[model samples]
Target chain A: MAVSDRSASHLGEAVGLSDEQLIEMYRLVALTRALDERMWVLNRAGRIPFVISGQGHEGAQVAITWPLRKQHDWVAPFYRSIATCLTFGMSPRDILTAQYATANDPSSGGRQMPGHYGSREHNLVSVSSPVATQLLHAIGIALAAKVRGTDQVAMTFMGEGSSNQGDVHEGLNFAAIHKLPFVFVVENNGYAISVPSAKELAVEDVASRAGGYGMPGLVVDGSDVLECYRVATEAVDRARSGGGPTLIEAKVTRLTAHSSDDQQTKYRSEEELASEKARDPLPRFRAQLVDAGILTDHVEQRLGADIKAVVDDATQYAESQPDPDPSTAMRWVYAEEWPSEAPPPWGFGTAGGHAEEH
Target chain B: MPAKTFIEAIREGMADEMRHDGSIIVLGEDVGKKGGVFLATDGLWAEFGDDRVIDTPLTESQIIGTSIGAAINGLRPVAEIQFADFIHPAFNQLVSEAARLRYRSNNGYSCPMVVRAPYGGGVHGALYHSQSVEAFFTHVPGLKVVIPSTPYDAKGLLRSSIRDDDPVLFFEHKKMYRSVRGEVPDGEYAVPLGRAAVTRAGTQLTVIGYGLMAHYALEAAERVADDGISAEVIDLRTLRPLDKESVLDSVRKTGKCLVVYEDNRFGGYGAEVAAIVAEEAFDYLDGPVTRMAGPDVPGVLQPRPRGLVHDQPGEDRRRDPD
Candidate 1:
């Protein structure tokens, strides 16, 4: 629990995670990373259509997702939140199946363009391709929770460039004004597509705008899983207690291109990419565990082997799954009819004639 | 029962809904202290206080977007956009967010909200103040578009929209705000969305329209009736969840159709009605469907008297020959 504490602890005390929990977190992160890598491979092979890698974001994602009560609280995640989704109990099979656009994909049933996954059971709203759209949606969900007198809070994830969107500002303003229970997590990986963060805004930190909205802003080392867990826990707790929204800026690194279609070398120099690789969050956390004696080389090797087996099985299962039926494309466009007087028009059923010509 | 103009009926409807449901709130620019630019939300600020009848900043996006959030949060919000032309800034929120929320969420939730704006061109309000944007919203599913031609339907349909579980784009014709008047009952009444009202039944031609164009159609129907031609006038109260049954029934009975709308002829709501008539009741048609609409050219600023003349009938003739 020393890692959960706010005070800084040396690498010695941090490695005391129960062996089981450490292995579980590490395995989940590894599966998420592997799933993303395999997705890129599929994209290259033209087997799958699109891919957005969650590389270098595993630590913060795993840490932030650990404390939240899935199926109770809501998550409005961005496209880059694969690791976060994995930590939130989405099976590796589910992620890979969705990537492969298979029928068994629980999130969207292969209907949505890949990566726009959502599950009502898990309280995760479907992700849209429009950047920063989820910010307002999260605020709206939190506001609904507030009005319904529920203790539930919503967490909205976005990137550094999304901070420049008007919807983001409007969302934060509304959340602050209404004191809605929610948190804004900006996974600042330094670049939005080809544009660098410096070219997007005057402020270096996206969290700095929280003050303008009369909310608390915290900047945390995104590579440090312990720091992420502690900050996210405090923020979620505050929101649940009706202390309003908190803006958390997670300083992570984007180890892969924005998407499989992107080439990071065009925008970032080789030296910068090399430095970022050196600070890769997974290896850093692993080193910390080793230095603390919480994990020995033997245990680490076994954990890796277990993770590989799980990911391999999931990938194979997903690859073998059947693609969705083309006719089912129109299914999720609207909800099924409820018992209301005027139910949604599901299919093309024309109403009987009652027209008058004037 | 009492005679009231379209604007008065709208005001009465908001006041009644506010009195009936504590959760109902009205917010927009100049909607509170100023009683709205068109006075459609008049006198309610005094009764509901500042919280329920709020005057928001001059941000259309926030006005409509916040209303969506508020609506989802159990508050029945009626957001006024001052004029229909100014709604472009908030168009994304309406189309992408509000319209899709219920559909995308699989009906787990709904946005019970109304965006009220005065539309049409007869008032000589020129470019920004007048434009029929209903076509834009009508194309978007999960949104109910309502345009009332009289006081009674305005009051009844506005009430229904407030209680309904879908986002409604309520277009109030600026020209008919005071020009159109009818008896609206004092007691609570709800005119269901998607149901058209037959203002006058005839046999020669089925004249179809809504809002200000409905009034014109009524007038034209009367003139045609004087000439020994029977005209059935149908007021399409809601555009999206269109009263297709009523429309097809009228077109079938009359065997002829004339659709009128104030928006440009190209890709207007009238085009949708024409397509439906051709597809569903084509065999019964006696003549080709005709449409009367505004000019395709962008509105120009006219000097005094010329501007006043633009507000008058026959000033700017319909660009379409039909």
Candidate 2:
């Protein structure tokens, strides 16, 4: 994971991204990190019950979404896809609303647990707690796009651990057979909770298994924002052109323990911990920008202050929002008034009295 | 109006809807070219072609999981699980994903899809094929469970389920696919959900059942009628949001109850029916509520299902309604 300190800004230039766009990319990565840090603080203060973080995954998450069409393509993100959601047009206010679980939280109106990112407005499918269940959903989106003959591509993510799930196999196989317009990303952040990748997957790389499904499997340096973006653009183009699905395994580092609940010391030794911390992508991207002369001391200071203010305001706004109405607890289980002509949604109105009708 | 078999009515319902709305798609194992294992989806592939009528790989989870995603994107999907027995593999997808989609999204999203599976036993198809699985899904609140006993009801209910903007589990009894026939209107009709159909009238006892058991209850009701005892039969078309008032009303008038099902007796669907009778209509004086269901075994054995239909306690003497 050695990031070249030399002028690595040329990476984005090769992909025709401007210096301003590259700076914005670093800003989003920093924003996701800052928002993640705020959630951890809220969880520890007993203000929020739980937290699922995207601290170390911001690089790949942000860059992969940069290549897709906003609001047109679909995203079926995993629980730790904060940067992806934000990069896909979800604001910090929206994310914080879900964390505080207010009635206005667009994800589920306080119904779903926080970090399970989804928004119909952004074409993000609702997430299921069960691992790998969203993979088929992403494929289904791609199937609909293909059926309608639309040039829309769908992207979905999974952890290295859930990659072993049956739905992954079924989804990848189906997408390949149909040559679906899809990009299946495995954010290989080294562990599935307490289980490391070695135990979860027998193979070294998750992308290697893609060959079995007759698709190209590419392993990228997830911390390299420009490199990740380049690979995603290629996949998205191939999907739109009907070249079929691609598996991109981005090897990321889990900067924190799995979640707030997990203890890092229980599983990893001090030496292994130091190794993961050294590969933190946020600082690498920041230094990469500085070396390329795109980021100056004054500009970096202003950016830092701006990000902090946004997070603080979003936090205050969400905390002030009211909890959902208690009376609405039973609402939305079934559509109370779905259009139906058949006897108009009956309720055994006649009951025993109906015996005389015949 | 023309008389149609149960299987024919189901196909016509899907076909009729597909013609009007271009968003509906049907996908499952062997459903396309093979026309479904029981010919329930026969002639649909030719009409809709490959894009609409898709034959998927042998993956049950994807069949349902894919439908859930498709439904969210505005393409109403009707996914078929070949048999109710094979549905266990996709249990997480249906219950965790499809059923909870709308609720979890707080109505921001709706999974307008139908999971059609053939359930129930009586066809000499032993263990694997014969199972009554309505009780499992009926417990799920967000889902609507519809089981039609007649051809007319099947066509009508199928139309309603497809149009309804929520996840529905439409379990058609495999035994009635060909054996049962009824007059289906030439055009469109829908049987409203969450209502009970009283197939026969009586006062001696209330016989509550659904699917194939409801048909069997009618025959059993006629048998007791010869002895000057009337047995009212209630066919619960929709099981989840049960037609409770109908069940209670029949039990209150008859003063006795017999809850029947082909599934296991211990904690089966009939147990809930009997519980409803004992809870709501308790004031009506009569003998104890009865349940005639299959034993709590793995599946149906030969002679077990047929004998279960006629197997009733000696109760020709009418109960007192006080």
lDDT of 1 by residue, A1-358 (tens): 1223332235423533354566566666777777788788879998889988889888888877776787778787888888888777677787888788787676667756778776656777767577887777677668667766768888988889988888787678878877889999999998888898889879989889999998999999999887887899889999999899999999999999988888889989999999898757888777766775556677767767777887789879988998877755544333334422233442124543222111
DockQ of 2: 0.46
How well is each residue in B145-206 modelled by candidate 1, as lDDT tens digits? Answer: 99998999999999988887778999988877877778989999988877888999898799
True contacts kept of 1: 0.22
Q: Model 2 TM-score? A: 0.94
Candidates, DockQ: 0.29, 0.46
- Candidates in order have lDDT scores of 0.78, 0.86
Please give the C-alpha DockQ score of model 1: 0.29
TM-score of chain B as predicted in candidate 1: 0.93
Docking class of 2: acceptable
For candidate 1, state the interface root-mean-square deviation in angstroms to 1 decimal: 4.9
lDDT of 2 by residue, A74-115 (tens): 999889999999999899998999888899999999988888
TM-scores, each model vs. reference? 0.85, 0.94
